[model samples]
Target: MKTAARKTRPAFLDAKRGVGNWAEATEWLRDRGIEDIECITPDLSGVPRGKMMPSSKFTSNTSLALPSAVFRQTISGEYPEETGDFRYDPLDGDLKLVPDLSTLSAVPWESDPTAQVICDIHNTKGEPVVYTPRNVLKRVMQLYTDNGWRPVVAPEIEFYLVAQHEDPDYPLKPPRGRSGRTITGGQSYSIAGVNEFDELVDDIYDFSEKQGLEIDTLIHEEGPAQLEINLRHGDPVELADQVFMFKRTLREAALKHGIYATFMAKPMQDAAGSAMHIHQSVVDARTGKNVFSNPDGTPSEAFFHFIGGMQQLIPKALVMMAPYVNSYRRLAPGMACPVNNAWGYDNRTTAFRIPNSDSAARRVENRLPSSDANPYLALAASLGCGWLGMTNKIAPGEPSYKTVNEGTTIDLPRGLLEAVSLLESEPDFARIFGQEFIHTYAGVKRGEFETFMRVISPWEREFLLLNV
Candidate 1:
């Protein structure tokens, strides 16, 4: 019975809410009676890492520092040994947090009046910390801007609602619904399934509105207790910020409703896996014209090149798109996920699907990334590959008309370590995403895989304990 209270939109929550300078941010905070500010940045794992301080001390000129080592830390909280391009500063130096006032918004779930702003990481010399996930995204966007092209993206993220459990050893179960029955079976687009958790869904909407995030649609996915949220398309950086914030908002809202929401690529066996499908298109920066279509309204060469780039580079860029060990679970053949980097028009099984639309709305939907991916890194890699394609005029292969099933040769990395190796060995990605970041990301992922290998799984114990 935890329903959100109806409230009027806050004045600070305008369309231009976060576009103003620090003075405007201060005014907004003051009007909302914000007591604290959460200065956050997305680390390699997409986890929010930063300090929270009293609003009185936050300003445009406020100097805050976090260790550069944060970017090198693995998801397991362990650091890999210094090797090759993976070494961090011996002093573990500080990186300054320069708040992007455009990302400032209220933390609506908080009882205390609080605000959160995403920050840009900078070294002591004021150069961008290129490995930070958010900064990595900005670096890619800069490439598009330099070429007079502006990339736009819309992400559809899927997740599941599960009963709260503390033990990771136990398999997750779908949470009980309003009828007090556990959710079961496929509920794709089921209105009743979505309405089962109507109160929680309301909170999610309320929270997103307060944070200036927009939800295009919410629908029940094919998996039990699974749901997907689509975000409106716009600038890659802003959409990344919204996705990052949306995850937090949904999780918080779920907790309040006495359940857990998970974005794991494959949180359960026998159920469909989760994915974050990105719909992308580039436009002439000056004219806001869709570059994928010509004046004749036919598919432009740039469109094919973008698909070619995705087909050629996504295999190497898999580490960024599917970052975790469990992420590979969602990419297996026959899982309703793409196993190859095939391109096709309106083909759900291919990695790149060009949806049917008018010339002005032409775009490619990248169906490879898992829900566990860092939104910033995912968008950066996806857009970076497309940028390379158009610039180099790479030609795409013939589109597929059939499903890429088990018999098809998989064009993607099958595991996390393989993905990391593929990424590290690809010089093109090193040039695009930076050698330093590639090294650090590979190192961290390698460490995570090693940590996972140390664990004994249920399958091993169930079958191998006596048989082996």
Candidate 2:
């Protein structure tokens, strides 16, 4: 294969293996009148867990250490006895929090002059924690780098703005618009719907600019009070970082406006599901040219194999794409969400969608992921699936254009238990992600499932309890 001309590596990636310039970062925050620092690292559940430190304590070589057990904790903060091996084996050990300096930015929404940075977890020996979602993604990127390929990804994440609810058991409603009336009607792509929240949109733009997140377009989705925002395409690592930070920023911005923003995959039973649809393309490491297209402007072999590889892995990789029990609810038979791995031209029915575009812009849109999945893990799984095909020259045959066509026989995992069972044992998946990560991630997932099953749902009481 002829390599593309050499392109410069993104600065953020260069620092992934090394610490960011902390000396200048400290002085930069001080110059901006930042007083406090929120140091955060993403846990297995994609939840941020860390401490807030005084700006005075911020140093060039600051080390934030915490127990490794935090990574094994379930979504509800419980540690399953089975998964607790990482919790307290002869007393829980510390993992060092190494901040990625490229992520440092001022927290614009906060009343206090504060800054925040995302960190990656490392063992006491300063080894990358393979189980950490961020580190896992980093390792996956290394696979592409080793092959002299770079992936460009842009994400369109959907979320909802709902009324504040103090109780978990209660259903959330759409918050009132500026007109004081709740946005109950499904106004998909309505400019009027967006105008109702101009203040919020403006605030989001201002906050994002201050935080270094390049947010692109905003749209009113099919669901009531739902907003879908697009991010500009760039390096996969930085794109993942932006998505993670953007989710938090939306919540903080919503709270300031007296509403709650949620990224739950299926927040409402009747509402359309929220998805984190990733648009991806590979570029030659040297030339920075799109690998999906040939010099003559035709579909390249890499493009075909990428789709073939994605189809091969979608069944097992769905767990990473849609990481929760609730996520399955979104993948219905006939809904907009994909339940099969079929690939087609601009088809929304398939998991792999090739949107109609020019040769230079040709890319695959993996629509399997929910808004709830961790960006780092989801992106890694997505790229790895395609990379597998590219390297092996996997051939995905004809595209389906009708219902009940090809790929219908391939039964996708319908629940979290089934997904995890597949993820734990899938050989190719473990190869792309490590065996250690598979074991650790599977343990955490099973713990969450077991805890979830213990709950008696409203449907159970409504049907099973009375009927029985």
Candidate 3:
């Protein structure tokens, strides 16, 4: 039996004692008269799940036993009764949740001054549960470290903010073009765009600074209401945490101002889709030099192997990259979306693009994943593919230079069914993701596809129903 190796150590173990631990966290709350705590753990779908505890019961010593089923719940948030009759109640064979003191952070949007902590679920035997998303990421990180390489990542997240609609019955409208009244505007990297959204952007910067996130830049993208935020590169684990927190913070901040923010890949079929393009490289653990860079100012053999790994495993990992039925709509050729499992030097048409920058910035950018994906799962899939590439020495194909919109072709999975089938058929991915996770994820997504197939859309009603 091949046991999974432990990767990066838990942040709680190395966290500064007087900074964010439970004791200091409690004192920080007491100083502000906070009377409530929002204890949460990210579910399979990346949604936070947990209960609010009163301040009196949320002391430093407070520890709750959560059920292992919380990690296996369906998209609708229900557990399978057939599996040991799992329920949210304490009497239902609950697992342990020892507070991860390092995750304690203030909930900036809450009026009562609440703090939130991300927890790790453990079994009765005090073993780390394998089913948890955090654990999956940890295991993958360990693989990288064991290989004598440190993975560094920075995510470029693109999203939109729209006007709030008061009427619940109002029909959804298509996103207007670049000419529409936007919160900001300009050519791709304009300072004027920042000026338009100055206040909101400032709030985001301030909030991130307080939370100790190393945010780099905020820029307005090509789409009318689109904006992108970049975080400084760091260890892959910390980078993933930053991605999770950044999305949560953006949503919370948007809600306070009565604006709607969405990370949906393609909110408008006519416009470019939003992507969470990941920039990644492997570094020498001791010297801190990027291992992917070569002396000739080109990618090293290891870099090609890493890219090959991505290409080989991407078909199987599509479900993780594009989690929803709607996500498939964004994978079409052209419109700045990648259609083929190919790589290029400074080309956006390819699935993986190597930016034409200096050796320091020479890294692969995977363009497949959307902003709505679970960050941990996406990172795991990417890392897994890269690892497989290195292990197998998979050769990367040639570069694609033509624009996807100009009829430049590469074969991509046509629809959700194809993607799901690809994932199910790949043995390499099955080995890494494990049987339980693969079944649960594929089952939920397949269920979603079935639901979507059975439903009639507005397009069908407007054209097919009337014409046919």
The candidate that achieves the highest TM-score relative to the unseen native structure: 1
Error of 3 at 165 (Å): 4.2
Candidate 1 displacement at residue 234 in angstroms: 0.2
lDDT of 2 by residue, 177-249 (tens): 9999999757989999998899999999888887888989999999989999999999998899899889988
- For candidate 3, the per-residue lDDT at 321 reads 79
Clash count for each candidate, listed in order shown? 0, 5, 1
Model with the higher lDDT, candidate 1 or 3: 1
Question: Local distance difference test, per candidate?
Answer: 0.90, 0.85, 0.73
Candidate 3 TM-score versus the reference: 0.86
Off by over 4 Å in 1: 1-16, 406-408
Query: How does candidate 1 fare on TM-score?
Result: 0.96
Model 3 residue pairs with clashes: 7-142
Off by over 4 Å in 2: 1-20, 83-89, 403-410
Instruction: Give per-residue CA lDDT, model 1, range 232-261, as digits (tens).
Output: 999999999999999999999999999999
Per-candidate TM-scores read: 0.96, 0.93, 0.86
